[model samples]
Structures are given as structure tokens and as C-alpha cells.
Target: MNQRAMIAATALTVMSMGLLAVPAAAQEKEKCFGISKAGQNDCASAFGTHSCAGQSKVDMDKTEWKYVAKGTCKDMKGLSADEAKKMKM
Candidate 1:
């Protein structure tokens, strides 16, 4: 009985320590925008600086990049290229 209790206590302690690590791991992923200089130029051209400003940019492929629009863009939800251009960035 004592051996079983000790084993359970040890498992609980290990699980608690792992739980404390979750927040730190989540914070590391908070930065959503990270793009190379070339990728930056491409996005700026494709979306235009006014529309793409403050949006998350990422290079999904070596030669291809994307700007992830948030906030106002999210309101529009799904917009075509022309519709997106008309939106306030």
C-alpha cells in the first residue's frame, strides 16, 4: 500500500511540472509574423502596403509567401482579391 502511494505521488508531481510548461510553450508561438526580406517584398507587391500593413506574413514555400490578415480582415471572413482591396487595412 505504501509503495503504491509513493508511486502515485511521484506521478502526480511529474504531471504538475509538465502542466507548468504549457504556458511558456504557448508564449513561444505568440509571434505569428515572420518573413524573409524577399518574402516581404513579394507580399508588399501582391497585397499592396496599405492593405497588408500589420498583417502576419509567412513564407510557406521557398518562392511563395502569404500575409495572414486578422482583425478587420477576419470581419470580412472570405473576400476575393478585389473585395479585399476595397477593405480598410
Candidate 2:
């Protein structure tokens, strides 16, 4: 293959591989509440006080959450979305 053609083919192959990996990675993680350190929480809070990641004012806040590996939340003693909501109430 010509130089430019080889580069294009390599880029396309890499892009497709990355796309295929995303869903599989996503499936391997789940949102685990009350596990993140202060200002280290992922994407919003259960109480709606913040709408962005890394905004938790307190460590291990029930309203804040991080994505933990699937089936490991209980092992980490992390709360579910419903459980976190009840704690905030």
C-alpha cells in the first residue's frame, strides 16, 4: 500500500477498535454511591446540589458517587442511588 493509504487504514482500524472497546468498558463499571473522596466524585450528585464531577464538598458523601466496578459496590460498602437518596432526606 502507498504511504498515505497505509496511514488512513491504520487510523480507521484504531478508531473502530476504540469504538468497540467503549461499550465493553462501560458495561464493566457501575455507579457506586458514597465512595468518592472530597472533590473527586463522578458526574453530579444524588441530591442534585451539583451537576458536575469533582464537586463533592465532603468525602464519602452519600449524595456523591463514583463509578465502581460492577458487582463490587457491596464489597466496597457503597450505597445505591435509592439508598443515597434516603440518607439525604
Candidate 3:
């Protein structure tokens, strides 16, 4: 096969595998976090109902609770406690 044809075939193979594997891979890596009832009430008081209400809830102590994110102090989907603490806002 010519160079161009070979490259195209390789690309097609990768694309096909990606199409079939991405969803399963994503599902496997997906994580679930739990929140405590007290934590929910605290969040509700601060951010209101919209922020507190979500599909997952983890029971956490309000005193020790520290919402952190990738690059900010605010609560976000994926954030480390250390990273969030470093964030100014």
C-alpha cells in the first residue's frame, strides 16, 4: 500500500476503536461523590437550592468541608483540596 493509503487506514482503525471504546472507558473512569444531609443544608444556605441540589450527595462535616477545584478555591466538578486552597477567590 502507498504511504497515503497506509496512513489513512491507520487513522480509520484508530477512529473506529475510539468510537467503540470512548463511552465504556468514560463510564469506567466516572466517579461518584457522596454528600451528607447537613452538608446539603449548609450548601443550600450559602449557594441556594440550585447549587446544593444535584444527582449525587455525600455526607460531609460542615466544619471540615472545604470545596476545592482544579485551579480555584470555589467548589467545582473536579478539584483537589490543596488546589482549591491555593486559589485566592
Candidate 4:
């Protein structure tokens, strides 16, 4: 292949690979409440204890969240995303 043709082909291949990799990497995670260990949360608390991740002073606080795979949180030992959203906290 010519230089320009080879470059274009390589670019196209890389782009296609990246596109194919996205969904597999996405894997559908959802925020599960009251499941995060101390300092291991995914984001801020719903109860206003902290403003960001990694600030939880206690494990399974019911106000903190951690990302769990979707459809699996309900089966887990903690609150599901929907339940967490409905919570007053």
C-alpha cells in the first residue's frame, strides 16, 4: 500500500477498534447506596456528609454510593439505585 493509503487504513482500523471496545468496557454500572466502604465511594453522599468521593468516614453509611453493575445491585446485600433514589437521604 502507498503511504497515504496505509495511514488511512491504519486510522480506520484504530477507530473501528475503539468503537468496538466502548460497549464492552461500558458494562452498565449503577450507583448502589450504602454499599461503599469508607473512603471508597464513587461520588458525593446523598445525605450531605461529604461533597465528593473518598470522604466517607464509615462503611455502608446508607448515604454513600458505589458503582455496582446494573441488574446486580438488587441481588447484592445493599440498596439498589432505584431504592437509593427514593430514599429520603
Let me know the TM-score candidate 2 reaches against the reference structure.
Answer: 0.68
Tell me, by lDDT, which candidate is best.
Answer: 2
Best by TM-score: 2
Residue 9 deviation, candidate 3, in Å? Answer: 0.1
- Which ranges of candidate 2 are over 4 A from the true structure? 1-26
- Positional deviation of 16 in candidate 2, in angstroms? 15
Report backbone clashes per prediction.
0, 0, 7, 0
The C-alpha lDDT values of all candidates are 0.42, 0.89, 0.40, 0.84
> Model 3, residue 12: what's the lDDT?
100
Q: RMSD, model 3, all Cα superposed?
A: 11.8
Output the worst ten-in-a-row residue range by lDDT, candidate 1: 28-37
lDDT of 3 by residue, 1-89 (tens): 99999999999999999899876555422111222344342233222323543312444422223333223322333333343344424
Counting only residues 3 or more apart in sequence or on different chains, how many pairs clash (N, Cα, C under 3 Å) in candidate 2?
0
lDDT of model 3, residue 61: 27
lDDT comparing candidate 1 with the true structure: 0.42
Q: Candidate 3 overall Cα lDDT vs. reference?
A: 0.40
Q: Is candidate 1 or candidate 4 better by TM-score?
A: 4
* Candidate order (TM-score): 2, 4, 1, 3
Q: Compared with the true structure, what per-residue lDDT tens digits does model 1 show for residues 1-89? A: 69999999999999999999987665421111223233352343334443443332443222222343333323323333454445435
